[model samples]
Target: MRASESDTWLAKMISPQSEDESEDDILYNDRKFSWSAGYPHWEIFGGGTRVVATDALTSSSLFSLTEAVAEIIKREKVTHAVLIQPVIDILMKEQIAIKLKKIVILGTVGFRSVLDCVGKICDELVNMYGMVEFGTIAAGSYRVNDVNTYKHKVLSVKPLPGVELKVTDDNGHLVPVGDRGLIQVRSQKRFTGYLNHASRWVDQLVRTGWLNSSDGGYITTDGFMVIEGRINGLMDVFGLKVYPFQVENAIKGMKAISNAVVIPIREKETKFCVPCAAVVYHPGSENTTQNIQEYIREEFAFTKENPIMASVYVPQVVVKFKTFPQTSNGKPDRHGIAAEVKRQIDPKKYECIE
Candidate 1:
């Protein structure tokens, strides 16, 4: 398609949309416009009355998704909006809710599933607009499947809203239910191959029906997959596989701990290894080292592996100055925090007490 023609087509797809249009059609167009809702904001039409803002209400399409969300809420005139996954609506600077006459979300794996992450937005809409008149979330990609034609094709899935795709692991078969593994996705819309590699494509049907989806998840009895963290975050101590979120959740509710990251540190004396968790305490709270150690010890008793019984207790919890570094979507950057913890911990003082 010519650039101008393509732009027009895209404009219609991402447009803030109106109540009169059919919901399914609007969702399809928006995905065609941009899968991740690039930038933050995009104007719905040439001279339309409404705008989509990620930050607040504004009349511009050439902005970030965050900005577009902001604009839509401020205008409050928009009767309908197609909120692509990962796109958030901010109110008074925090993501209070996504406002639209009607809102539809596309779903995928991970915590940002339309229902999980979008609850707060839905709540805000109810509080302000007296309940959502119409809302729904579905797994089908609005871009890949030509809802009108309904043709089935491979590698036609849309790209994730904003994130890179890589082969996280290649040696193993898909893990059993409840086990975590790599997340792999095969898509033609993905950016070009790396510097040393030639352009490549994965035939999901040949090796596995779906892209590896390097993320680790387990098939719940109810049939929904629960995405655990990444493959890189999985730790094996004395043969028991450890998922950080499992540990984080155990300690997350503690009143004194703001956050926690579990890391595997090698011991020089025994030439063996075990997990060590560096916790960030609530600001201004006097964090006593003894109490923190006891917390980890007590919490792990409820876990499947119970690493605290085998691993050494960390001496001083690394207190970061502020919030943990976050990926673009606001998920804590565990790898980044692990690196920071390694740098801060003194090697000579590496001693674990049971």
Candidate 2:
């Protein structure tokens, strides 16, 4: 595609401009768009650096996409990269030979193994957290002075300048430090309102002017923030609550597993939700569904006093996949995975482990 045509196509994919928007509204949105696209990081990428898009231009499998990026980095002699966690994992697994000076991680929290792999190759590794509604909320770079200290601060992110973060319970009360709750943000750079969606924006904003992030997380005593998962993605098992990321994190902890996404599947008879894991095992791994289920059972095993807690956390069913479906942006498609799991596995076949 021609340069102008390709730029237009990518712009449309990011956010389609509308002819109906007023001049002021268009100007406001343009500013917000630049912020979300990492405008603040331009200084790091300055000084006549040649930048290339990491995303694949055409539809391709995960492996092919990895190969494509490695080729671009090598051919362009790129020194820096900003990538999502999944892309980092693929590059590490393939052991691609593209050297870099700095890497900025976006989209999701970096897995410990992935971070370690990148730390060895890159001089600097930065983790950034934000949403499209707001832009670049919090970001922190690993201390290059000590590579051993990087893993400990993988989840610790500092709020960006002029941005404030707080965790609140369901009743809108502030939760104690280290207690998981809904994460909220107040920032001067936040978008005023969605295009023609003023009511939606009002609903998300609280009387105190904080925007509800709809993300479940906690803050440390030292004021570092740790995001657990999306609050809306929580599963209700009987009466207990289960976070999908908690289960997925436990499953991925196994050496055999490479990646996992835990989703809720509602029981046909009772209509109650139960966690089901869709896992992608490492190549040459001989682990089966039963083995993964057993691993999780042991990971969350409880004593006689609190045996019931184990059931709430453990996934009842496990399904293996060669690769997960990806969206346009190359992130794992959670909705597509949930739909595929329901179509392939029968909920009645597996019984909850109690």
- Which candidate leads the pack in lDDT? 2
TM-score of 1: 0.46
| Candidate 2 residue pairs in backbone clash | none
Q: Where is model 1 more than 4 Å wrong at Cα?
A: 1-121, 124-206, 236-241, 253-259, 278-321, 326-336, 351-354
- lDDT, candidate 2, equals 0.65
Q: Give the Å error, residue 97, model 2.
A: 1.9
TM-score of each: 0.46, 0.77
How far out, in Å, is residue 276 in model 2? Answer: 0.4
lDDT of 1 by residue, 152-194 (tens): 1110222333322222335645555444455454432232222
Model 2 error, position 154 (Å): 5.6
